[model samples]
Target: MPKVIFHKHGQVFEDEVKPETNLVVRAGIKQFPYPNLRYECGMGKCSKCACKVLAGAEHLPPPNWKEKKQLGERIDQGFRLACQIWLTHDIELCQEEITA
Candidate 1:
């Protein structure tokens, strides 16, 4: 298991998650301390789960086709679909910090 630190509202929601756990599942398991989390297809087609990867982007699994497509031209901006982010190590993530 890897610890995930989700930063929101200037606070951190830390939780231990399985390596294969995706952000949406983790969020749901821990309940939403984070935001902008919605699911329609649950297969990463919809971008409702879009999140900004403020840090630890390298600690997650590589982007899948669905995420790549949904993120489109924002991949370089650290935009990633939460449903597609598979945790690989302890990671710190934040949405608001993306623009900072």
Candidate 2:
């Protein structure tokens, strides 16, 4: 299992998930990080699931084309699409609150 630390709206959410877990999929199923992990389009087309990796970034693979297309230069800043990440190691990340 991998421990996930998710920060959003000044709150911290922590959970242990199975290896290779996708945050968006977990959220969609109303698991940990749900209601905090803002996401749409689990296919990685939407940037709504974007989050900044605060720790354990080295464990993640290089960003894929969708992340490169969606996040652009922000990738250099450690931002990644949760939908596109399959967690196999502990990770800490933050998602800024989106205002309507």
Candidate 3:
């Protein structure tokens, strides 16, 4: 199992998740972090489930074609469509980030 560290709404949650677990599905669970994540399409088209990777980004598999198109240039900045990604290893994710 891989550990997923989630940061959202000033809350931090760490859980051991099975390999290849769909993040969108996990987000839908009340016990998971970011319980309010929206998914209109349940596919990559909505792009509403995007999250920011703040650490251990290398642990995730490369973005697929759908993520590539939806994320566009944000992909290069560690943004990923959670609906299109699966947790493979330890990762620190934030639902929102404030940059100055």
Each candidate structure's TM-score, on Cα atoms with residue i matched to residue i, is 0.73, 0.96, 0.81
Tens-digit per-residue lDDT, 1-100, candidate 1:
8787776666767777777777787456655433444444557877766767777888777788988888888787887887776777877766553342
Q: lDDT per prediction? A: 0.70, 0.94, 0.78
Expressed as tens digits, the lDDT of each residue in 1-100 for candidate 3 is 8888877778787888788887788767754644645455658996877788998788788999999998899899898888887777777877774355
* Winner by TM-score: 2
Candidate 2 lDDT, 31-89, residue by residue in tens: 98898899999998979999999999999999999999999999999999999999999
Error of 2 at 74 (Å): 0.4
Name the lDDT of candidate 3. 0.78
Clashing pairs in 3: none
How many pairs of residues collide in each model?
Answer: 0, 0, 0
Q: Flag the better candidate by TM-score, 1 or 3.
A: 3
